[model samples]
Target: MNDVLFRTGGHAARITLNRPRALNSLTHDMVLRIDAKLTEWEHDPAVGTVVITGEGERGLCAGGDIRAIHDDARDGDGRASAAFWRDEYRLNARIAHYPKPYVAVMDGIVMGGGVGVSAHGSVRVVTERSAIAMPETGIGFVPDVGGTHLLARAPGELGTRLALTGARIGAADAILCGLADHYVPSAALGDFVADLAERPVREALARHVRQAPPGVLAGRREWIDSCFAADTVEDIVQRLLDHGGPEAREAAETLLTRSPTAVKVTLAAVRRARGLGALERVLDQEYRVSCACLGSPDLVEGIRAQVVDKDRAPRWSPATLGEVADADVERFFTPLGDRELGLAGDGPLTAPGTAGPGAGR
Candidate 1:
């Protein structure tokens, strides 16, 4: 079957991620196809809105196909991985700025690449089954796909906590953290999409939205803000350790398990993303970091343990935050010289007028 299914009917354009058995993990070809379709439908007068979702009962998308990246890294060739990231990041930028309303039905697992596809849309929908996260740190890489842009904009230091821990959040928490916009039950999603095909997007969505449950992050915002507001990962860990609460201790332990380099880099990325003026700028920074990590051992090792071997025990280089030098962390943020991602455009996929969503957060 096609990895992705795209169709246009009535007043809506629809795209479904079709790889259900793999949780609809995005492939490089899939990203390019999505960009093409969005570009084609952007100015179609009959298409008032675009709707994206995944096939099957499992979820929307788990993430990018990490095994592909792992294999490329193992081969000591970074071309494929690098090309995938460059294109994926550009697709993300396109979605952020698309002039017509873009709707993402985040019905299930929305993490990593999935977040890139959904979270930036103008209308982001979630269901009771939604489990949203940017769990890249756990895989020995900082969150990309403009993850830092959304996480950085989250209320308080919740973004920092989420970035470092790679923790999963429910639908309400997804809304609270600004990663999602509406909460519609799983049962109502079909009817909502049907209405979207025949009626105005805002009206269709408004009619289906329901009250989300109390968010877990909302109640802990004060503590999350205090503990994660530190300047470095080391400082944040110390604060979490000293806080002497179960949540704080758990957060600290989770950080300990992730790549020390990734933890430090993620802290810096989220902090810097907060000051960025545009999503493209944030994506540019992420591309630099991603390319740097492609040459590092930790990323491959992390994927081996978590996905390949299922060991869940990765031996990260520079094993502790203290062992990671400031210069080592700085290397990930440096310019890519000739290989930088270039996303300038005046096409249908490009955002109209100002910088698209998540700009100036």
Candidate 2:
């Protein structure tokens, strides 16, 4: 079956993530197809906007197809996974700079790769059912797909807290964190999309916009800022532990559950991303970190325990924050000599005026 469906209606070109059974996890082919379509629509005068959503009630997208990636990393000499990320990151950059309004109906679980596609859109709409997160730390990977960029820019230390803990937030919190633009009830999403097909994109969205209830994150801002304000993951954990409250204890414990190396690397990535001026630069940095982790023992082991084995007990190398040396973390941020992520216009993955790989067939 087709993993994605695309059609044109009225002034809008619509795309649907069709892998409902898998929570619409993105694949290489799907990413290439979406990028090609977006590139086409970017120049088409008839296409005033683009709208994307998932096919099912479960999720817009859970993440990249990590299980497939795990297999690729094991058998394909990492070439397949590397190519997938390159194309996916390029697609993310395209969506961020698309000439026309890009609308994302982030109605359900939007995590990892899902965030890459939807949260970066110009018009991100979330519903009460939306459970947005960047949970890469739990799987021993730093947040990628420009996730560090979004998380780094979140209010105060909220981004740091979210990055470390892999916490899922509702629509209100998503909006507060700058991950979403508007909130509409899930029931009203269909009507909103219908309106988009007939009216101007902004007008349709404005008509459906409703005030989101205050998110739990807003109330915890003081705690988040105070606990996560430190420069290192170790210091953040110490602060949380020393604060001596249920929230603090829970936050610390959550951090403890993630791969120690991942926590440290994620902290460093987020801090670096704060000073970045462009999304492309942030993506470049993330790609570097991603390639570094691709062959690391922790990434493979973490995936095995949590995904392949389903044991829920990943024995992370450098099992504690103290064991993860500064040099170990720095290597993840270093430039990738020949394999650097090329972010120049059109990039190395797709050429201008030519169909992207997997575009037509």
Candidate 3:
């Protein structure tokens, strides 16, 4: 059976991630197929909106197939991992620029690569079951697939708190973070998506959208902003510890649990992405960081412990935050020359006649 299934009906085109047992984890082939499908749908006037969802109750996607990443990074040269990231990051950029209304049903356990495929879309819908995050730091990897772009743009340092702690936020917090657009109760999703196949996106959303339930981040922003605003990971940790709130202290302890190198590199990546502005540029930078991560000992070991061995104990090489020098973090940002993703739209626009986003809606 296909890992990703595509179909067109009425005013909508659909892409369903079909690996239910794996929480619909994304793969390189899935990425390529989705990209090709998007290209085809973009030219089809019959497709008024494009909708993406997963097949089962678990999630739209858990993440990329990191078991493969572990094997490639551990046993082979890093070229395989690099190619996967190249196509994957390009797909993320395309979603950002897609002229059609791209609707992502971010239903459950959306994390890592899951965020890439869903969050970049123009219309992101989260259900009560949605647990959206970019939890790469926990596995000795930094967030990629335009994750830094989305996180960097989040209000204040809320993004910093989420990135460093690898925290999962619900529908309310996801919308608060600008990671999602609307909230639809999980029970109503079937009808909501069914409506998409028959009506314009605006009409379908009007039928089912509701305000998100309350979330924690709005209340914790005072502490989160003050603590995460520090220049370095070391200072951020210290601020969280010094704040004296249980949540702040817990966030500090959470930082201590993640891979030191990964957290440090993540902090730098998010900050740099903030200044980088365009999503395409941030994605280009992310491609560099992701390829650099493939070379890190932590990437393989972290994957082995967290996913392979199921030990949940990663022995980060730098061990402590201080051991990761300024130079070490800087290496992640270094360019790959000809290998650069070049996703910055140097060429002509994809749809000159298209106004994009709200056009067909």
Residue-level lDDT tens digits of model 1 in 192-236: 999999988768977899999777888888778999998888888
Q: In model 3, which runs have C-alpha deviations exceeding 4 angstroms? A: 357-361
Task: Locate the minimum summed-lDDT window of 10 residues in model 1.
Answer: 343-352
Number of the predicted model whose TM-score against the real structure is largest: 3
The Cα local distance difference test for each model comes to 0.89, 0.88, 0.91
* TM-score of each model, in listed order: 0.96, 0.94, 0.98
Among residues 3 or more apart in sequence or in different chains, the pairs in candidate 1 whose N, CA or C atoms overlap within 3 Å are: 97-351
Which candidate, 1 or 2, has the higher TM-score? Answer: 1
Among the numbered candidates, top lDDT falls to 3
After superposition, the stretches of candidate 1 with alpha carbons farther than 4 Å from their true spots are 344-361
Which whole-number lDDT from 0 to 100 does residue 202 have in model 2?
A: 67
lDDT of 2 at 99: 62
Worst 10 residues of 2 by lDDT: 352-361
lDDT of 1: 0.89
Backbone clash count, each prediction separately: 1, 0, 0
Candidate 2, superposed: residue stretches over 4 Å from native = 344-361
